[model samples]
Structures are given as structure tokens and as C-alpha cells.
Target: MALPERNNEGFLENAWQWDKATAEVIAAESGISLTDDHWEIIGLLREFYKQHEMSPPSNRLFVKAVKEILGEDKGNSIYLMQLFPGTPAKTACRIAGLPRPTNCL
Candidate 1:
């Protein structure tokens, strides 16, 4: 499928344009291979956006949300860092086609 339009940071310009294929393209551009674990986080991010109309504004908040939904083992910063590397909240939101977190650099 043709890729959707994306911003300079590679986030989908229109959130509605997001899909698994779009996410794959974005992740590939970032040199990430999307495993099932990655998909779980992506799904969680999307659901969070749907409910809150925004991405988590910080790693602490993201981790807390994950912990509430997915439990401590998968929700910690270490697991997220391993999955998205660098800034986990920013990278995951980008790949999930959500807006960048408010306070992220």
C-alpha cells in the first residue's frame, strides 16, 4: 500500500491515516523491526490517544500508563527503552501515529 503523508519527524500528518502498514513504514525508516511486543506498545499508545486526545507527556507518565494497563514487567522504563531506544515516549508516539508528547524535546 502507498504510504500516508507524514510530517518532518515522520509522524502521520493525519492520525486517521495510520495503520499497521503505515507504522511498519515509519518503524523501518527508524531502523526498527516491529515485533509483537512493539505492536503491544503501539496499540497501547493508540488507545491512550483515543481516550485522552493526546500522547503521554513524559516517560514517567507513559510508564505509569503502561504499568496500569500492561503490568510492571512490561511497563518499566528499561523495557520501553529497549523497545524504542533513545526517547521511548517520543519514538513510540511517532510510530504509533500520535502527536509528540507535550513536554518531550
Candidate 2:
């Protein structure tokens, strides 16, 4: 099943309201600058809308994604980690602006 399209304006009025501290934690752990470039994959994942109806495997996928987008010769996990640390899944998902993950339990 697909996730309901969130195209409605103001639908996010109560979505992922990250405070300054939470945003900072996500940034510090993920190292991904909370910028447009960092948001590309998140957008892509949002569109993915897996059968499970949730965000994709973020931390695990970040490495492979970097390699695919930036080039396999250049997308190393250690480096990506420096850029997006923690579980990578957490960092990626949060930055992607998706909901917090479930398996993160």
C-alpha cells in the first residue's frame, strides 16, 4: 500500500515538529548538513512508499545510495558515516523528513 500523498498544504502542521535541540541532535549524529542536498534521498524514499508503508532502511541504504549517486569509487561507509553518523537510518530518515523509524526499537 502507498502512503497517503501528503501534498495537502499545511498537512505537516503537526507532522515532525523537531525542536531546535532535536534538530541539533539529528545533525550532530548524522553529520548530514540539514540542507537540500541531504533531502534528495529522503524525498526519493517518501515516494518509494514500500508495501510495509514506512520509510525504507535508512542507515543501511545510505552507504549504497551515496555510492550510486556519488559513484562507487567515492561512496565509502566510513566517510558517509562522518557525514551522516549514528544508525544512518535514523539520520537519513529524520533528515529525509520522514517519521521516526519503527525498527529503531
Highest lDDT: give the candidate number: 1
Give TM per candidate. Answer: 0.94, 0.46
Q: For every model in order, what is the number of clashing pairs?
A: 0, 5
* Tens digit per residue, CA lDDT, model 2, 18-67: 34344445455444456554455455445543434566555555456566
Instruction: State candidate 1's TM-score.
Output: 0.94
Writing each residue's lDDT as its tens digit, candidate 1 over 1-105 gives 787887787777788779898899888888999999999999999999999888999988999999999999998999999999989999999999998888887
Error of model 1, residue 89, in angstroms: 0.5
Candidate 1 worst ten-residue window by lDDT: 7-16
* Candidate 2 Cα errors over 4 Å, as ranges: 1-32, 50-52, 65-76
Distance from true location, Cα of 17 in model 1, Å: 0.6
